[model samples]
Target: MKRSAMVLLGLVVVALGLAAKQLPGVDGGPAAPIAGPQVAVGAPNRGSESVGVELGPLVIEGRGTRTTSVVGDGGTVVLAAGYGVRTSGAAPALRLSLERRVGSGKWESTSAPVRQDEHGLHVSTPPWSASGAAPATTIAYRIASASFIDAAGVAPAVRSRSVSVVYENQAAYTGLAAQIYRDAAPYCPTTAVRIADLMGDVAGDYQPGTSLIRIDAVVGTGAMARPEIVRSVALHECSHERQWLNYDGTNEGRKRMLAAAAAQFSSYDPMGVGATGPSGPLKSDIRPIEHAADCGAMALEPRGYLGYGGSCSPTQLEAARRLLTGGRY
Candidate 1:
């Protein structure tokens, strides 16, 4: 190899060496991975670690840089840094755990079907995903010792350094959904929502029974690649919610009232002002319930991206405003 290539190789080895130093491996005898789940308080043998683990980002090319990754609500997080086991303790056991907390809320273990405790630690592993998050909540995590470590022998640190990753709901990572829900709150107090595959380009729809707004997961993936789309979806869905509550929100009466709204909004232009192509008739936008929802979204913001390809007329918007503000449907 050329001198330059040799030098680069040397640098890579040195970097790996330095990275390994962060999580020192056990030194006494060869370490063995502890087996089985060690979370139960009364288990005969919990588990132990050798190199244990460390927090760091996971690089797709290789190992993540030697630092905990930038955590989001339900996104990337460091997995095992250096895999190993602890064979030093008489009652050999290691306790690995993941915990989380909200603002000043009690810290609670969130270990689930995933292995809570492990003995072997690898240099790099696929990131563990976090879920069930709300907006602005801090989530803390760590791997630690369940049993006492023998200080006299060479054993891994009793507890892995505690680290944290703050993430948002995977479904609403962009905060647009939450914002939409909050914006629609005054008109309809309970603006509940769900994010699902929802198939193709369909961003969202207001379901009748549950009365919950549904945002499409397929389009909203990857930190909401297109926030505007999600935002528009939310606005449209919220409009439907407002429509439902505009009526007494009783059972069959609500159905009749919503149908009446669709009929009234049917003729209203969905493309608001400055709309050009897709010429002829944006049929879907003019459909009964969808038209009403589109108009409602237009009423929210006529010029804003209300639907797939349309907005409402000024007169339609005004009517929607009055209906949304306080008047009956």
Candidate 2:
């Protein structure tokens, strides 16, 4: 079966207009989704007089020069370096540097501040915006440590590092989506979002596969809004994923009943944007499908059974609670 595009009907993002809400940040054009091959570069070399240490999500396996390329022609590398000294758990001092290469020529290095933590070193370099003549060449860099003793059974005391190379590249945007994927994999397997392409109101589609739920970006927004919004939205949509699985992807029957119940909950639009009256268009022109969904959504919020957002007063929560839980306060 062909995959269905996510429905953006009756959405709310800066005034829902078609699938525009699905794509955020960049304009809705013919641009392709960002992803590319990983460039291979030389690793920083190490010597026998070096010590190796292991850190969470970071491994200084052995002293070796590593080369990684940025997405743009002129980018800056924020390299962090640190050392582990045997002084009552007090980590040693550290330093950092920023290097820039404007073209396909030699790298220009500059000093950067290094902050040391119990684990390692960290640095933040200025934005790399000048790469010489070639305005779009990749920025490559490497990190190494000063000559230190190879402590027995002790991790290497090399300069621990983390790099943040900035660029006005599409791949960087994809990296943002990749971050969302990382978060969705473990905690929100039933729901996910790639914000890079989310437009105005058109959110992604929800498909619950045999093992997990997949939400692809038809349109995405840039890395905007706090993660709390993402978490809340994803959690909200995840409830739909469960609903789909439980109802076998069809809520038509339940929607009818919920729609009837929602009338009692509705004094105005569920989104708090309009009014709902017997003589108004809300009763004649509005669709109850979304109201049913909103009913379920509001039911899940904290004290949301009390209904917040629309003209629907907190009193509606009492009715909704009774409908769902036999009037149990």
Candidate 3:
């Protein structure tokens, strides 16, 4: 079975039509700009670094980096680096060093061994403790690297551009969620749901494997500005998480569900923009999952669920209603 694409539905107003009004930032209003460098809490720092020299035939082709922060379960800050180097013979021994700073404090360093694959060399620092840090603490990081002893003994080194991320404690996220949905305040503490605020183009996504809910920085701030939209998107994504958790009541069932879900959305144009094709019809498989999600969101935020505004056919509507009322997927 094909693996499922990440279950992320970009919050698009055009797709929803009249339901568009229910979401903020879609009404031709000025989008809430991401304040700061616009990096996700644990995504790699952006920009590239060049290795000026070469080790035998090996040359750094490209650099891919990501950093992200995780809240709850003893909070952590992670830094990862991926180096694309071209070499056919013996690969070089790559070493990675990561430095971190919290607030005005001095920098602390950690080093780890690098692992190489067909694509490139990859390495990540151990999860740095974020347990006692203040909410919204800006954590700055620098990943430095050195490669030595290829086919011939030679040392080449490079440094990545500096990157920074803010750590939001669980309490801080709970407070933010509570501000949007009063019910969510207790839900966070009771269920121990982890929320990771991401920056850039991401809206919001939930990873069932990790039980991690990622809320785009833009979406989170927009929700704060328009509290009503929060419940709709939040509950919608949360419902997806529920489907992932249950996923037909067995491991194999969950895998099939993932493959189906991934296959369903892959047919759409990126970001659900425009039409699926020149014919201008949305993919048929998308209706049921989306309808189910919308119904779930509506069940929680009834005032906002407006029946997809004729987007669904009578048959699809009937199925969605059954799922909504009877909890049958």
Candidate 4:
């Protein structure tokens, strides 16, 4: 066949493959495929002849009464997906499938299959629920496979893709924000903490919930470096988070939590320290939290290999020690 004829033949094969089946919910016109947000997605390495697959914007919407008991009150939980597919002329028709609550003791299909169309593939399948099911906490959805014929032979290239369960009347992200607020509220001298990634001559405030944590996004002679380092810093701050959440929700409570944290720093895994705790140089303070937060940081080995300097200030350690030991010393 001539080059032009070969190209045309390839196109014809792909068109036929795409038109082979209509998914249960697809409209069957040119698809307006959804674009996935820029995110760091972790998928297992599955070597296949398949090219990259453009995932659609997946949204989970739900509506139901808020209560300690009872699942959705016939409330609607919709799973919508939109994506596009391109294939080799000789490949088989791409098949799309859905699976829910994966890895659980039992596997089940929550919704029927929908064919991919020119408009790409979309689904707004609502799960059936009675008014008396247990309160809905989460729903997990996945694409079982997108099979196509490739040079390697008949195979389902993409293993699976999933979206975390979304609660009703709430976005998946809003819940996370709310959780940050709730966890840090009491520790927060003010409403919320500020987070930033910038340059400063001096070390910035390292308050638990109040101070914004800085994450270095750039790379150069001077930068915060990688995400792991930033995350380790955040974990240090989260010690403050635990301080607030477990306390009595009062100033005295905050002090108590801090003091208790100081005491337990040695008991629990200190920063920088490995599973056995800090093994390096020690700080001046006898309190453990200081040891863990500062000196422990030096010991605990973070994934990013960002080295720890020292433990927290001795003043706070003494204050906590005074409280824990009832000021006897």
TM-score for all models, in order of appearance: 0.41, 0.30, 0.43, 0.29
RMSD of 1: 22.0
Clashes of 3: 9
Cα error, candidate 4, residue 99 (Å):
1.3
Q: Write the per-residue lDDT of candidate 2 for residues 1-329, one digit (tens) a residue.
A: 32332232122333223321333211211112222112121222344322343222211111113223232322233233333333222332323343445446676564655444543444434445432443233444334333333223343433223332324332332443444434333323322233433333433333222112223353234322335333334333443333333332222323434445446533444443222333323454332323332343354443222111233335544443333332211
Ranking by TM-score: 3, 1, 2, 4
Model 1 lDDT per residue over 138-249, tens place: 4454444444445434444444444444433334434545655554555544445555554443555553322355555543454233444345455566665555445543
Q: Stretches of candidate 4 above 4 Å error?
A: 1-57, 61-71, 82-86, 102-106, 130-133, 157-160, 166-329
lDDT of 3 by residue, 1-329 (tens): 32332222233342233232223322111112222111111211233433222212111111112233333333232233344443334433456566667688987775554444443333343443444645545666665556644433344665665555544554544544544334333222211233344433233454332223455445445223345566665665555444443443223344555454344332333322122234323555344344455545555565553323323233333433444343434
Query: Residue 1's C-alpha lDDT in candidate 3?
Result: 31
Preferred candidate (TM-score higher): 1 or 2: 1
lDDT of each: 0.44, 0.33, 0.40, 0.35
What are the runs in model 1 whose C-alpha is more than 4 Å off?
A: 1-177, 219-228, 270-285, 306-311
Model 3 vs. true fold: TM: 0.43
Query: How high is the lDDT of residue 176 in model 4?
Result: 26
True lDDT of residue 302, candidate 3: 53
RMSD of each: 22.0, 17.5, 14.0, 27.9
Candidate 1 matches the true fold with a TM-score of 0.41
